[model samples]
Target: MSSSTEPLPKLFTPLTAGDIALANRIIMAPLTRNRATHGSDAPNALNVEYYRQRATAGLIISEGTQISQQGQGYIWTPGIYSPAQIEGWKGVTEAVHAEGGKIVAQIWHVGRVSHVSLQPDNRAPVAPSAIVAPTKTYLESGFTAVSQPRELAAEELPGIVADYARAAENARKAGFDGVEIHGANGYLIDQFLKDGTNQREDAYGGSIENRVRFPLAVVDAVANAIGKGRVGIRISPVSPANGISDTDPQAVFGHFVEKLGRRGLAFLHVVEGATGGPRDIAPFDYAALRRAFKGVYIANNGFDRESAIEAVESGRADAVAFGKAFIANPDLVARLERNAPLNALQAETLYGGDARGYTDYPFLTEKAA
Candidate 1:
């Protein structure tokens, strides 16, 4: 446990990447808090308060906002393509900025983690190959086993890249400081990057360069739409979530990160563990990947206060992002400054409805009484 009386180290150090300057090295990782309204997937008042409460972090990555209707994977996750949705996100950006916080929108596509009910006219989900994910997606109604996805034709690849570009434009319109391409956790981008899911033999698969083509194209398009200084990419090389795995992960991810570093993007966010499973099972080499990426690096996955601080102090990472911890500790920056104890998150209330475990968690000052 961290001691409250110890003199605080310079954990609140300022950082500069490209044109943006952050107040500290702690960031709030994008977390899906399935509180969007049914049917429309629009952000509600609770969503506003949820983000507003955690405005003290150096940077806040908004939950994975779907880039298109087909990009959705879970029920009640927010979207960025609609006017109402953009308006909702605008309010969130404004609130955070008012408190001197910077925010980035995470654009996503779920690929095969989607259900039939969520698909286009009950069509099969889309992927690089016709394979079903080895896992199921949790929904409001119930869990739905993943079905084989329709392999994307070469002609369809360009449009998917365009969708990511358009979403980056939408984030700019919604007043975000930047955008983070969600290429991690077995989502659409990861599905395209991993050989276990992408069995294509054309220009898009069969080799390490081919497997990373789609994700790189999407990143290039996004960086073009928004300036490279305002774009970041997140990736989890060994993630088993949503049934994604890569053979020769070192070669694949090493090439990916090296290429991204040349792009001069703002930062690279790496989730080092099996993001959705136990830590012991993850397979990527964080130290090797860190050496591969030359730009600013933000490390995520199962970090506590001391570990997070050590990561920065020891030069292993430029910053650290928190997921579950930020949910209960709204004033996380303040808590770290004061060396206060953190609030434990309730697993049941992570997704789905209302303020019970969402906006109702008290600050340490309030909890002390």
Candidate 2:
């Protein structure tokens, strides 16, 4: 849109985010495709091919991988707990690395965003409080309402933190470039962070500092297990995904990010407005968040090539993450480079499906032919 005198966008430049070195500024965001091995809940050959096809991305953040059985909220989503699961991921990492791409495991715990059927021993889900999320979880049958979660005891807190630490250790064993703690999207960390969901008088509830305790504990444990440079966390202060809300997102998240900066983590991935929704869904100062985090700032949500370029060249974001765009375009980086048209996304096949929408999207070369 500019004159020929204007400089090219830096979206394709190479840079390093903590320990992980990227080939470009265009990143592949973590997407949940329920295609893992059915019973084992581990990454399989299909996932390996899927990731390998998109290895041209600057960095690939793997789908939300549950840290434990209790962390799982959806079926067929991969986990990083068991030895078999770790072995399954090793193949994925090796394939990505072979293609000169960097990948990080998104260690996750869905917290109260799960149903009873998905829990261990068919028990109720756990959360900071006993509130039921006004959301649904996809099961083998269909999408159903989330179950009522019981309040987790103080003693159980350390075990959950341990699970996060163990997941990071397992990610290292699985040959991942690093691990991204899934602390966003109204999950466990977000549930505890927002006062709308958490209503307790304990040390983990009430004020902003008290609410951030559990999340910080998990971050510290994970960073201890892996180096700080190998760790990053995702946060969505104003996002209302999965029925999450905060009375004061600014004050709570400001304090949270300030504390995170002191830890010297790799990057801070922030979902600007709402998860997969409007960017102006709420009144938020994303620039303030960028200022708070001293490390890399990866901006996500509704970004096109031009905006992505502007974000990087203007220093608003160190990098930009593409979610649905990457799903339909394996060679997304190349397509963007040439200003080529993108493939149409098959929305129906986005979830639990075979290679039709997963890896069957044609490349630019294939389309040209």
Candidate 3:
């Protein structure tokens, strides 16, 4: 997203994608604020208030909520699996809706990008292969070494897909307008898509076809459980964040993107760079993927207001998602609309805190009041 001098740029235009409609083109990219109930991993009042404050975004994709106990990676992030969790999220979706906003739950599973301490019963985190990511996972104590994970048994794949489907249904029951499968940022789905993480010789690995098998299966299951038109997916084609690398991201993601388009998803959010990092670390044909997808393509990562406007106007993206920019400026869309100065984000309080950096960011009206 880029900053601009002109007001009412292309970024503010309304758009419709499948069953979901946006009042503007600035989607709030899901940011893991780590403010959930720690022990239960449930969405709480803080999470509700945080999202409600940002309801002006065209669409608010909630922070990546784990789909199961095994899916958790870090402390204090919410889950959608348990009955209590579903009830918890009901408050959040209701709050957002009360403010006249649309929101989708970003269902996630961290795969090998986790530590034993984060897993149930201190079990090893599961992944496509037993590869240990050179990544660290945040624990209540602090960031700790990510342990090597157990390779998911071939028979266990279907259960994971089932979990996703159930989670999608749970999301709807929790009052979310839809669900966005967390297929990006080197999570479970990304682990299977990229060759570096998936080394299995079985039907779920080896060739690109085999590698993408489980991920696509998960998508189909989720789509069937929830209407395809209300489902979305997020992917990082060339990003090597979280110790993930692909031998050929272009070919791998090109194939994946084309297959995903065939599912008639609501939208496809593509992270063009390492998650929350630089864009030029690798060369990728984002345009090609956009052309291949044939649906609403949301370009994310490293975008300012002006660049976001350019992307929507130039037809490079149907919308642009803003992440960190939304942390401090809950009224981000309003500020962008008025071209107003922004409040600085409190970096120290970003991950875990009270309403200080979460919901206390004053709206423009609040400042005047």
**Each prediction's Cα RMSD?**
2.1, 1.6, 2.3
Q: Model 3, 104-127: lDDT tens per residue?
A: 999999999888888889999999
Runs in model 1 lying further than 4 Å from the true structure: 1-10, 276-283
**lDDT tens readout by residue for model 1, 78-159:** 9999988888898899888888889999999999888877777878889899888889876877666876788889899899
Candidate 3 yields a Cα-based lDDT of 0.91
Cα-based lDDT for every prediction: 0.87, 0.94, 0.91
Error of 1 at 329 (Å): 1.1
Q: Which pairs of residues have clashing backbones in candidate 3?
A: 1-303, 1-304, 1-305, 2-304, 2-305, 2-306, 2-307, 3-306
Ranking by lDDT: 2, 3, 1
The 10-residue segment with the lowest total lDDT in model 3 = 1-10
Task: Mark the regions of model 2 whose C-alpha exceeds 4 Å error after superposition.
Answer: 1-8
What's the C-alpha lDDT at position 329 in model 2? 97
Q: How many backbone clashes does candidate 3 have?
A: 8
Colliding pairs, model 2: none
Model 3, which residues run further than 4 Å from truth? 1-7
Instruction: Please give the range of 10 consecutive residues that has the lowest summed lDDT in model 1.
Output: 1-10
Error of 1 at 213 (Å): 0.8
